[model samples]
Target: MAISQEISYRLERLILDGGLAPEQKIPSERQLAARLRVSRSVIREALHELQGRGVIETRHGKGSFVSTMVPGSGDLREQGPLMHLFEGHPRTLYDLLEVREQLEGQAACLAAQRATSLDRHRITKAFRALEETDPLSNARPDHGFHQAIVEASHNPILVHVLNSLKNMMLMTVQASVANLNPRAEMRKKIVLQHRQLYDAIISGRPASAQKLAMAHVRFVSKSMRDLELEGSTLIRVPVEQEAAVSHQNAQD
Candidate 1:
């Protein structure tokens, strides 16, 4: 990893692991640079990365401090519903959804074949907890439940891939809740999909489970794309996308 990244990781670890309390100020840039034996410029760069991720904040006149909203290890930052978007910055919503379908489908398949009794129980508990949560509670059981599946797969490589997907999942969930309807019917469908996947794993039917899991992931990705397009065409305009469209229109 680059020196800046290494410095960022170390600092993040310190804050996240409770070495630095929430709203606690960090050492000066010069002090940090001296301790890490890196240039102050490198420290600043690393700090900027952390700031973008909402791990820390800097006041204009005051020094930097740990963000009070530091997302947990399994937080939306790490494992939420839309965490997949940062991977190479997908060219389009369609491309992003397609990549998610492929990765999550594989995770479901591996989970089905390798899940233990404990994993089944944990997943079931997560699903039950989801039924009790609402958009207001801001509980992210879905991300954790999916991550549990990946962990049950007993594949280190798959875990790494899933890790890459975590941030996208989180961001996606937040976006969906912010804009999408997420009505009762949609909730039922999500619950059913999770149940089917879980049942296939518990029954020791890997192939069937894999098929269902992949189908479910594909369904979600497609839904997101449709919603994005719908929002673009029918409802509130997406400023980010609109800017691109405006530029294109101007050129044309």
Candidate 2:
């Protein structure tokens, strides 16, 4: 193979193997040449080839970034209508959680079975960040931890589908965290669940990882439902009290 072709092939493998995450900036030509002991011209040529194939994108003044395999927000407006629906009906958040239960459970199972050393390191880092974050403000970190697990699955299609649903997932996570944060007991249970899930993945227990992940999401779903029900009951109590008072005055 030509030197440029070989270089392009190696770079493509890096992206496909999850070494270069979607939208992550690639090393500059100079950096790549130095790291690979190649001439800058060759590196540039390879980058150009990858760009042609839509595997990498170059920003005018910035640098090259790995292109997302699936269309992102910039290239696709399909998620717009779905976002509107999620916002209009709060119940859709439960639907989103149900989807999460399946995808996340599978992701965890795969991660336990296939996570490389580097993948484990990233997952550990994300888990620590989540643990350190305040429960009330940990939505982003929580989502990041789950995303790391999904990426560790090393299933390109799974990673891409979850990435495409990034907005919806974060929305559900934010709602779940916000509602559960105020309840100290629920917060403690969630923290314990995360720890158990992380341990299962790190220990290479696929079955345990899948079970723990699904249970965690289900617990969140149940908590959200309970909160909603409590809120509705609280709302009804005031109305009922007003009705009873008015009725008594009429009877008097």
Candidate 3:
């Protein structure tokens, strides 16, 4: 396969398999090229193709993002467990975070009350791994650490809900790091809040853990809102793209 085609296929798999989720911003062309050991031009070609197919969207200052794929590219019927998704809505992505704040706070409270010795150990290990790292450098691990908290909660329903929304969670993580990493003070505050949340969960402080979880999610919500107000240059979306199967990515 041609280099650009190979990259395009690779990204397609990620989106289809949910490695990339709707509204999740992807790496910059330069960063993607670096990761794939290819030229920026190759990455650019793949991205434009992805864009044309309605599998992704690009904003001039914000970089590319995984959106809903083109019709016939995949099956996305809203049935069974995911019926609530319906047609999906990117503008309401923030609504998920608002729900996550409440749901995850309850998870933290459950973890604080019910976590066994091993669960506490795992939660601590996960949190510690994320504690000091630069948020911009590795968002996946940061995302994993938070997932660990839900696991520690020992509640199957909570775990299932969070797992179903994993892609969205990672998207939020990407957005958080993208916006906050450039601001030293805010980044530090985020890390500190994460640490405090971890401490509360592991130390068996249910109320504190719940409070911290709510606060942390609220901070993430505010950060995204702040970014929207910044008004970065926008990439012009081509009009002839394939019909998208789900929500459109929010563009400038």
> For each candidate, what TM-score against the reference?
0.52, 0.56, 0.56
For candidate 3, lDDT tens digit of each residue in 154-204?
Answer: 889999887666444433223556556557887778778888988898889
Model 2 residue 138 CA deviation in Å = 1.5
> lDDT (CA) for every model shown?
0.66, 0.78, 0.72
Question: How far is 152's C-alpha from truth in model 3 (Å)?
Answer: 0.9
Query: Number of clashes in model 1?
Result: 12
Residue 225 of model 1: what lDDT? 63
Clashes of 3: 1
lDDT per residue as tens, model 1, 77-147: 34432434444443444455566667667777777777788888887787677556663342356556676
In terms of lDDT, model 2 sits at: 0.78
Model 3 residue pairs with clashes: 60-235
The ten-residue window of minimal lDDT in model 1 covers 243-252
